[model samples]
Target: MKDLDTLKYFLGIEVARSASGLFLCQRKYTLDIISEAGLLGAKPVNVPIEQNHKLGLASSPIFSNPLAYQRLVGRLIYLAVTRPDLAYSVHVLSQFMQEPHDEHLEAALRVVRYLKGTPGQGILLRADSDLTLQGWCDSDWAACPTTRRSLMGWLVFLGHSPISWKTKKQTTISRSSAEAEYRSMVAVTCELKWLKGLLLSLGVRHHKTIKLFCDSQSALHIAKNPVFHERTKHIEVDCHFVRDAIKDGLIFPSYIPTKSQLADIFTKALGQRQFEFLLRKLGISDPHAPT
Candidate 1:
């Protein structure tokens, strides 16, 4: 293949490069979503979902058209590729796709409205960012109104640029908040190892111990302490894995205060002020906005 110009757009993502760094956004994709949803000229919202909103299976009337909700959620999932700020909202709405409810549809629409506020908002990878791996892991305990499963959220940053993140529902019900946090750490540990391997394959030198920040002291203690007891027996397997990782010098787990936990934005909805704060910290900004 002949050499082509630099990548300006690919698979709905619009990429802009400069001396500062690369700015990637999906403005057209998001606008199309809003247009298809008939939300043109709709009033924009600051946050995607209401703070502490607990969506349940039996919350409202069944949506007449399941296919419509499914289609919208499907598109939102793709949009999340460049809009990590919308990750938690999209993940929450996707859960209701099998059996759509009017409430769920409304929530999804709110996300679109939120998008209307700043469709150009996307990730920024600074040119001067370092190569050191940094991660933040957090969990929302017993947040689901239906399954009661905890939500685990983590972000892996390569230097100042966030390279990976996920918001997932735990596979098993956790007995305590600490248990949920510990399980979240376990998930992050696995992700970190995979990322390290990927970096090594690429010939990138990142031998410095990866720093993993978690807000749960109990979870860190459980991972560091070798002793297992009746309280942590249910999650002993995960404990051992985390302990081994720490012992092997793969990751260094440290405590970060809740307010400073960037991963908090992924596990639960926050008020507009706090949500925007975390959004900025995540390096998501509206490229079209005034400096």
Candidate 2:
């Protein structure tokens, strides 16, 4: 192992070791964002989005200059790299990039305001936590108002530290929630398989079958079963890939209840209480806490 002084950074996220473990806040970068958006003194918010709020393609008056909205949204997207808590909200606003309105701009500013309050918050990568790889996957059925596309989200952890995650709209629409979730599992399986290979190359050996937790029983059945019918025919390709991975011992997709699904935080909006619960589950610290 290299000396403590020699360790600089990893994956663009700076590192600062301490007696406890490592402190990993991007305060300087976050401040720069706040300054750039002229929101350094803006009122801080408790949450990224208001309770029960719905945002969709605006049918109202357009902004005087759409580029201004685009610029702000662009900055928020960068902020989300270390703030998975804001992923779903940022993504929802991003869909309005083509023609954003005053309301959408205000909603995006609320996220910035939230960031103002929690600028020091970041994932804590404890030194002694087990390095075993574990993951959770989830999806929201027909969550997008315009396209009716399901949102798929997954988070991979090296012990308690989240190393990778994604929140994206499925490429194809699904007829049922089961199919939407199964497609998400397939996506997560493909990612886990690649990560396994990469880890092996780096001499980080792990079990042959990486366990992947999902919140859909039907999806798990489809991956574990070989039967193909009309309901499963449309997603034949994804089904085959996931099943093949299971057969080859590359990934083991298991069932997890919706309440415990960590990936749900990324796939859609939730009530404030549920959102806060999932946020803590993702290992994000409370910025308001005393340092």
Candidate 3:
């Protein structure tokens, strides 16, 4: 690899540098997806998924063209490379790919419409910000109707730039919100440990506690508490790995308010105001000049 003057491309995301900072976007790819979906003339929307909209298998006739549904989903999945904010929405929509119907099509189109309005939106890595590793994990209990499985989500940041994130439905059904949250915390803890190890291998040590923030006080209490009772015995052995690591001084789980939970963007849908607030918090910015 030769030393380049400006970041033209990296990991499939087109990077454009400016005097202020680096702006990353996938505008060309986004436009191609819009055209392929034949939604170029569709009105743009401010938000991706509609607030309070519950999606499920359509009760009406399913889409005859499975390829069309697959194609749109594939585009959206690729769009997620530069758009971590759309992870949850895309993950939810991708579930219906096997048997997509008109409802699913409309939901997917809503996301495309949203992309149309904010095509230039992407992660902004500021040059002056401190590169610290901080993370937040959150979960939504029994969010899936079919399996009643919880969704686990977390966001890891190197300073202001979000480097890692995930939105996955839990494999095991959680009996309570606290249990669901604890499971998510464990997942985040494992990621943090791996990140720390990876950085150390590259001679980049954080030298501080990798803060794993969670919104559930019950989960936090469970982690700090040693005595497990009958109610908590059902939790999987792997989920307790976080608690063990905490004892070994590997990670420190911290408490954070729900409003400030950055990982909330990944677990479920949000209103325009709340969603935009978290988007800004995640270091996503409009490539265009700010109004």
Candidate 4:
């Protein structure tokens, strides 16, 4: 067995440590993707995707090369490992990989261009984090124009640093925004439970109830209230664990205003100002950005 020196790089991710925190990035990998996408000389955009974009309805000509679009989006999936801010953008782009069109390709390139300006942006695990577990969950009702399905996004934090995040579509159509938001709460609750188990296995016992925040007051009421109303009768029985978790003291439900919802970045394409504002709340930064 060979003895390796201090950790530096692994699996295309670059790692660095300092007095402040441990930083992880894919600067080389990001640059390679941008250059291959032919956006190395392109101007950077403030946001990854356009606001209120009808990407699902884009009717532009089919891309001349579908393979290129698939390959580019595939690379982005890898890059997103350390770039939580890219989660929503990559999710939206990957959907069109099967039959990518001109507009789809252009949107994928916009993501690359956004990365061009800050290739070194990545996760920072602070040295002095408190290690408290918490999470934010959100949903965009009927976000899919094709299927009329909802989209959900969540971000779980181990202390101030994000450890896990995801943006996904609901399998079933949600009849109301509250239903969509409640479904998202259920999804994030499951994630927080698994994370707690992982921490326990690491000898970090978290006795306190994990906090899970949502912007929907209706969903919070549904989870906290034991008696189900006829309005919520349609929710799947198996998904009711969210209420059970609250009863077990495993989760503490809280309310947050929509404008301040950190999970908004994962659910919808936002204007530049709102997107940048939410990114800051997620503890994401570009330490490598020019001063």
Candidate 5:
């Protein structure tokens, strides 16, 4: 019927092409957010959230206006689609939208200030011959101060390009770091299965088993070894599901060093050095950065 032109911009996301591949960013939308919040000229920060600073309800003064807080956080959440660096911070701040405190509002503003520094920062989906499905999953165990629940983060890469990702809180309280990591592995496994099926439907042939990486060796052993049955009793169902995937040759779980963990950026706040390093590793860069 109608053949639309190639996508340039859709729903606030700007798309650009280069000899390398595609770059997606929300520069205009990010700038509008800063201007709306009256922080256009505000000082920029290196990272969105301060390390070791845990925010919770009743931690600071009640915000004068709750509506503004909700609106700001909602917009930031939408912006995270193209800016994975903002996912952890936006996910943290969105929790207090109902009755945000002054500290929460300040934290949200700090994220906007960070965005001011590199509004053009976005994901780079490079063109590659490799079509292998891979993923990195990580968890911050009991990072929440109030509930003591853990946070899960994952990134699914088709060859070198990150296509799907998530930063979310786990539904259940994990007893130990290993358990938390194992649960994250389960989540990523499910994502891999769906992604593989989608590729098949699109007529993309991938015969190799998807490889999943995690920094936790204990989690890897838990998925492969039946000896940890006692310790994994609580999560027995999850264990079987993951083990079955490995057995059926659908996924292959492996270990990665902590420093090389790509999903760490999604689970917690980081210092400037490590944060920028991981950002580069994740293929997030601003072509407009000072030369």
Candidate 6:
């Protein structure tokens, strides 16, 4: 086997190391996407998607080229490997793959334009970051205009470096916001457990209790108290494992105010201020920016 030495690039991810930590981005890949979308010279937006977007099953004209939309979204799905900021937008647009509409393609192109602004932006894994596993989960209740299903999202951090995150639409309908948030808590809890085990196998031992935060006090209450069973009977029995994790001391669930909810970016589109603010919070930076 040929020894390639230190990793510089792998599967489109460009890696760079410095005194602070390891940085990864897809500058070339991003540029290619922008060019393919014919937006290399388009003005960039402050955000990937507009807040309160109307991207649902509507009577709008079907896109002339459905394959183009599908291809763009597929590339974007890979792009999100290092660009979590684009995840929600990609997820939303991906739903119309079978039948992309004009508005959907516009939204996809908007993402390509956004990339033109900072194609080299990526997440950082700081060398000085502590080995702490913290997580935040949020759900946008009934956010889908078509299905009325809630979108659940979460962020898991290894100290200051974000390790894992996802935005997924809940399969079942949630009767209340509390139920939606609680379900998101369950999703993040599973991810945390899986990550903890993976880290342990990699020879990193986490001594501190894993902390999971959420903005819904009602969901927090449901996880911390058994009395809520009567109110949560409709919730799947499997989701109840979140409470078990708490009881077993595997995770500590806490309440965070809405404004401090970093996972909100994953659950729904947000204003420019909140979007950029969360990007900073997520440890994303453009290392290629001019000094």
RMSD of each: 1.1, 2.7, 1.9, 1.1, 1.3, 1.2
Q: Give the residue spans of candidate 3 off by over 4 A.
A: 1-6, 18-21
Shift of residue 2 alpha carbon in model 6, Å: 0.8
lDDT of 4 by residue, 132-214 (tens): 89989999999999999999999998888888999999999999999999999988988999999988899999898998889
Candidate 5 local lDDT, 1-291, one digit each (tens): 776788889899999988888999999999999999999999999999989876864577789899999999999999999988988998899888888898898899999999999999888888763778998999999988889899999999887878898999999999999999999999999999998889989999778988898999989989999664568888989999999999999999999998889999999989999999988888889998897
Q: Per-residue CA lDDT of candidate 6, range 1-291, in tens? A: 999999999999999999999998999999999998888889999899988789886568998999888999999999999998988999898899999889998899999989999899998999998888999999999989888999999999998998788999999989999999999998888898998889899999887889999999988888878764566887747446987888788899999889889999898889989888989989899978898
Which pairs clash (backbone N, Cα, C closer than 3 Å) in model 6?
none
Number of clashes in model 5?
0
Deviation (Å) of 239 in candidate 6 = 5.4
Query: Superposing every Cα of model 2 onto the true structure, what RMSD results?
Result: 2.7
Give the lDDT of residue 218 in candidate 2.
89
Clashes counted in candidate 4 amount to: 0
lDDT of candidate 3 at residue 213, scale 0 to 100: 91
Runs of candidate 1 with Cα error greater than 4 angstroms are none
Full-model lDDT for every candidate: 0.90, 0.82, 0.85, 0.90, 0.91, 0.90
Error of 3 at 65 (Å): 0.9
| Cα error, candidate 5, residue 133 (Å) | 1.2
**If candidate 1 were superposed on the true structure by all CA atoms, what would the RMSD be?**
1.1
Which candidate leads in lDDT? Answer: 5
Question: Please, what are the lDDT tens digits per residue for candidate 2 over residues 80-137?
Answer: 7777888888888898898888788888888888888888777777787666777788
Instruction: State the lDDT at 26 in candidate 3.
Output: 84
Kindly list the per-residue Cα lDDT of model 3 for residues 166-243, writing each as its tens digit.
999999998899999999988888888888888889888777777789999999988888878976888847547877
Which stretch of 10 consecutive residues in model 5 shows the poorest summed lDDT? 52-61
